[model samples]
Target: MQSIKLRIGINHCLTDNNDLRYNGETLSDGFVQHTLWKYANWIPVCLEIETDHIHQTLGCQSEHINDLSKKYLDGFILTSNSPRHDSFRPKVGLSKGGTSASNDMGVFARSLSLKYPALPIEENDRLHDPLIRENFLERIFTSKRWNIAFSNSFTPHALIQFHSSHKFLFMSHSVSLYQEMGRLVARSGLLTLTELKDRYVVLMSSSLKQMATPNKHTNVMQHIMGFLKGLIDADEKKEIVETIDQYRTGQVPWIVPITLLNLHLRKNSAADWVLNQTYLNPYPAELMLRNIV
Candidate 1:
């Protein structure tokens, strides 16, 4: 029932639509921006810090990047637009006011990249490319998924539920890994909880590397259709099949079929299991990540 909240440190990622207020009806304080959502529960310590807090401590203005480590955050986002941040590499900094300066975004970026090479440290410009943005979202969301689902509970039952919810999404990534994950979850009692969790993490990391292709997505859509058997009328089934076929043939994006599935479930109130699958609402529909993927 908990939403994945990402603690992204954005220097200047905001545009005209920065603050789309959520009426707090959900659970916590958060806002939606374009297609992105920022939750208060994202980072462990965002609640403790004041909204007006400048994050400047002592002489280091680039200190916010380090905040991830201190607060046990899953990841960080450095979406800056300045030339200095854009032109910076791991060790290189601008020449003027040399010595890496006191409070330069470039220096901060360099530090973040060099120190946390494995973390999701991205810039806004590079993310303009569709492919790059897709990859970034995958990595960030996958990492977030691990933290949210498995981080709290490592029992066999918990693992099984986690795998069940992400079943279709995993199939879209790699059918092979999807099968392997099911096997691991099924055999969870055979191994220690820690071992199972470790193996699942390793597989999850590798499984999502390859982008979901049309064929794989078609496989999931087909599988979900099986769940709706006898529930949909003949014409409704044909319409759904046609939409899936369109997505498979690349005539339309996955959004079309996905939206259709959501509507069907909403109107008919299918099985609870079907409705609970994260595949139907992996992230926010506003994100449109699937639309581009």
Candidate 2:
């Protein structure tokens, strides 16, 4: 059972008040629901600024960002033309930064990314790309795992345990990073927990940025399937292999092959390690991240 609430902050500068009413796409809602599974409830936090109240109590750009981040864990920002004024505009090169207009609406999008570098941020425009969307969700789920695993303690044992669970996930992304992460964890006795965490997270995120291709995923999936070589008969093993091959060819979704492996896991106790490997179930089944790619 899960108790913590999962949140994704949405920061956007609305050109009109109608944007505040509703845009009417429940994909975000469903995505959260599926990713969190049924273990916990969902409370979606969104910040829409139609006008920047630089003089207003909550309209200050810094406060607006602080307040929004306080409520949500991660977020998306929508880009649009916004009226620019000196009061809220930076004297420095605002346009040169690749940020939008000088107004709060335009600039806050860039602020969110800068403020939360570890956050999985996607712009309203770029998120339309399948690859970008998948990457965002994958990073968000990784952030979720970090939140859960590191919430309580950062002892050496805890670090090792967390690393153990995620090794396969790292391997699927980058075997080199996997080995490097393991080496760092092995040195927990020599380094402070804080240092260990900081270094490990940077490397973890870097590795995941490599993008999990079909071949990489198939390799991890098969590696997991291999654990039960003798337990499953020729026919059953062949079925799983063919299913994974189909996924490699893009004939079926990742969920199909993974679910098949899970069934085998349930049938055999010898494959207990497969259950702990994050590669098998990194996020909730409902997310269907595997379904698309």
Candidate 3:
């Protein structure tokens, strides 16, 4: 269990009482409101509603970047406001003339990335998916652990050991990149701690992006299947193929195959590092996050 509740920044447009959304309808996802809310401390952020006292009182604020630093938030959720109604007279800017870029969520997200280069950031819509949400939840906890425990000070071998322990997760996205990262970790040989941190951050960000989108996530799962082919027997390979087929046909959730892989890996005596990963079982088993499929 987490000793501290994660502080996450959410887009204010999703919660404000005022009719700020372009669709003039409530934007609600029950999982976020009920499940995630129970586990996290949410801080609302809105640049457009900077002056709305009512919204401010509700916890929405304009200066989120500074607040993020001060509070040491664990993650961020960027919800889209779409285009405001014509009556609202929305601000326009791609380069400051109320351009698209100025009003874009990417602008704010990019700023967050630049300032807190290792923060776990995700768009709101992606969190609607159970798989993506579970992955994000794991990342939030893992990142907080890294920041609080190992970021500032560590022994000479701590960073390398940490990287090696997380190699299973690093394999979740690109096999080539994962291999290259392992090579870099080996070659660095106890120096370049800052560079290793930056690489780890990039790995987290890239893996999240890949798994959040359906097509990309499909590719990711396929890659995982490919990687496991040589390691598992013919029977296990067939089972994996069937599980992936079910996933593609909407018969099962995505976590089924991943859990399967984890199970297989755990049986290998040489794979003790896989046993050390708590992220695989991040939430209580009763939550059925992995069993939903």
The true-versus-predicted C-alpha distance at residue 292 of model 2, in Å, is 2.6
**Residue by residue across 53-124, what tens digits does model 1's lDDT show?**
424332353455565566544455443333234333233455686666434345456766666555565555
- In model 1, the number of clashes is 0
Error of 1 at 81 (Å): 10
Clashing pairs in 1: none
The 10-residue segment with the lowest total lDDT in model 1: 21-30
Kindly report which residue stretches of model 2 are placed more than 4 angstroms away from their true locations once superposed: 1-4, 12-59, 66-106, 125-130
Candidate 3, residues 98-188, lDDT tens digits: the string is 5465243344555676687667766667667667776777678767666666746864377677666565555554556667767766766
Q: Which candidate is the best by TM-score?
A: 2
TM-score of each: 0.66, 0.73, 0.64
The deviation in Å at residue 86 for candidate 2 is 19
TM-score, cand. 2 vs. native? 0.73
lDDT of each: 0.64, 0.64, 0.60
Instruction: Give the lDDT of residue 233 in candidate 3.
Output: 87
Evaluation by lDDT, superior candidate among 2 and 3: 2
User: Weakest 10 consecutive residues, lDDT, candidate 3?
Assistant: 82-91
